[model samples]
Target: MGERKLLSPEIVQVTVDKVNIIQAKLKAVQDRQKSYGDVRRKDLKFEELSRVHDVFHISMLRKYISDPSHVLETPEIELRDDLSYEEQPVQILGREEKRLRNKIIALVKVLRRNQIVEEATWEREDQMRSQYPYLFQN
Candidate 1:
């Protein structure tokens, strides 16, 4: 029979180092996912606020444009000429809304990509855990 083999100290140390490196990489990926989620949330909130602002501005402009005499009586319509500038606000809001929407779409795409990567990693981890429960068990 062949002699029994034993792991040398250097080999054991290398194995431990590899495991630690894998664990650190996994943690970094998880942290990155969390950061992306937080950024997405903030973008959503900003989009919502921008939508509200746009709607309010549109409503006010509509009121002034549709009934100039009545709105002027309220003293809020101080300058009739400013109505010409209303279109600019609408255009600006439209551009901002579009930008925010695009950002949201981009963020969602990134999140989906991250999820796919994480899912694959999780599956591999699960398989490893099942195959080597003793090694993974705390």
Candidate 2:
């Protein structure tokens, strides 16, 4: 004999909480974009690039992404209140970009679990070989 399980109120509440959390994250990203558009940076083209440039400083990003211990070894950043408002967006972008990268990794794992490889692959190796940052750089 099999028993039927019923949904508890706590489980329903947890689902609702998760949705709310996701909505808040989306709103935060939208807010960052709006503020970004409002700012004027001569070096940056707002229309061409949005938050994607957040991690353009690859060296700093790699330190955080690949070597967490190194980042932890640095002096505490929170105690320094000397940071400017302009610096906030850059930090936000780096964090969001890292989150996006992590999500991509997670997605790849899910795809593998489903017995599916990449959605699209390079048809030719020669064609796929392209220039590095130079190709996409300003």
Candidate 3:
């Protein structure tokens, strides 16, 4: 094991002086960085106009109170092992016949579960009937 030297008063003073020097340099660096930020910052003043209502007191502004109705409740969707969930048709919105090159194809606007009216997709009526037999029971 190496021999440890006993700390003298002079050696302790020297170490404290070195630490103070380092702290002074660090403080100077921090002040210089703060001065750079101060240089970029400016006071904003709005001019008073006859008809313009630009600035108002903090008391004049009303705090936004969010309504419970504004929050949309999303229905829970079950996922399979592949992270893909099957979409179930809620109801048939409308039916349309598309004239193809040779035959007339029947299309249905299927309102899927958890989907909005605008998000409803047009699927083949025959395909929807085969898949969801409960839909055509009525």
Candidate 4:
């Protein structure tokens, strides 16, 4: 077979740029996670807060009792806009990171085809069953 061609400098630079962009995004996502408490959300540098809608401060014991003697619930509008971007599951962040990393690897592979992971031997469906008779049942 002929020798594999190397990745162009332009392709590598573009891939690097994409990787940097994703890294910045990941940092922003992480920062948002810490915004759950009041201070960070309030401290946001947004120019306008109109988008933060339907904010509420829920009381824990509101549902348990319903008597005049009980203190009245004081539900309040907490945030002016939705800051949902600040919150994402750690699993999701991990997945996103993996996705970006995979993209870089794919781009790199365009210039050079190399295996990143070796397949498990057990996945060979065409292999003779007699080779591992213990794996089969009567």
Candidate 5:
């Protein structure tokens, strides 16, 4: 069989250019993935808050049902009575949950924006890959 000839210089140049463009696109995708990771982490914080809120709500409901009058008049006093004197920790945690919930909402908005950016990036990447299937075909 005849020996295979090397790629022409023009073909080599074109391949290099294509590779550079793909590399740039890949970097952009990676940056977007990182942004998504950040947003996902923030989402977890909200999920955690949701869990705490659910528990607190249940406990508050139980207290109200058990002692409606106390709960109605001087809820603050009843709340304090319901918790131990070392309740400072619980109060701090509640505050943290609220803060996390607010932050998580903000992050969700950012995530939605990133989703649009990511979709555009993926569309471009898919277009390039389709145009030069050999470049990305595994």
Candidate 6:
């Protein structure tokens, strides 16, 4: 057994009116928010102007102060006539052997003069010994 309760015509009309009023209010709020958001929204469409690089308007750039500590101190190196200076080995840091397909190549981590420890490079042990014989004296 089920109770069949029916709504009156006046009550149905009142419910429809309330729903329309709520929908109207919701639409008004949505339109207001959309208008506010559209103010800050940008319609970005990119078109390539050049093949070399993308060009940007200079006005978009901001002036920035260069860091004083970023300037590196230039090392005093005696350059020869051909714009090349002889790199003197300061110290031998470490030694390792790299195994290839057929043979193993001996490498020495050498720290050069007037350079930081981080700038040390790995050089072939045989070539380094031949070039700077004094480094291998010890």
Q: What is the model-wide C-alpha lDDT for candidate 5?
A: 0.45
Tell me how far the alpha carbon of residue 37 in candidate 4 is from the true structure, in angstroms, after superposition. Answer: 4.9
- The best candidate in terms of TM-score: 3
- Which residue runs of candidate 2 sit more than 4 Å off their true CA positions? 1-4, 41-138
Which candidate, 2 or 6, has the higher lDDT? 6
**All candidates' TM-scores?**
0.28, 0.26, 0.47, 0.25, 0.28, 0.45
What C-alpha lDDT, on a 0 to 100 scale, does residue 72 get in candidate 2? 48
Arrange candidates by TM-score, descending: 3, 6, 1, 5, 2, 4
Per-residue CA lDDT of candidate 5, range 4-114, in tens?
999999999999999999999999999999999888774333333444433455455543356555644432332346674321110000111114534532111111121
* Residues 24-129 of candidate 2: C-alpha lDDT, one tens digit per residue: 9999999999889778545744565545543455565544357556654453334346763221111000111114534521111111111224432222222222
Report, for all candidates in order, the number of backbone clashes: 0, 0, 0, 5, 0, 0
Write down the lDDT of every candidate, Cα atoms only. Answer: 0.45, 0.43, 0.93, 0.43, 0.45, 0.94
The list of candidate 3 runs beyond 4 A from truth reads 1-74
Clashing pairs in 3: none
lDDT of 1 by residue, 13-111 (tens): 999999999999999999999999888774434333444333455455543356555643332333366553221110000111114534521111111
Please tell me which predicted candidate would have the highest lDDT against the true structure: 6
Better of 2 and 3 by TM-score: 3
Question: In terms of lDDT, which candidate is stronger, 4 or 6?
Answer: 6
Give the poorly placed runs of model 4, Cα more than 4 Å off.
Answer: 1-3, 37-138
Ten consecutive residues with minimal summed lDDT in candidate 6? 46-55
lDDT of 3: 0.93
Which whole-number lDDT from 0 to 100 does residue 43 have in model 1? 40
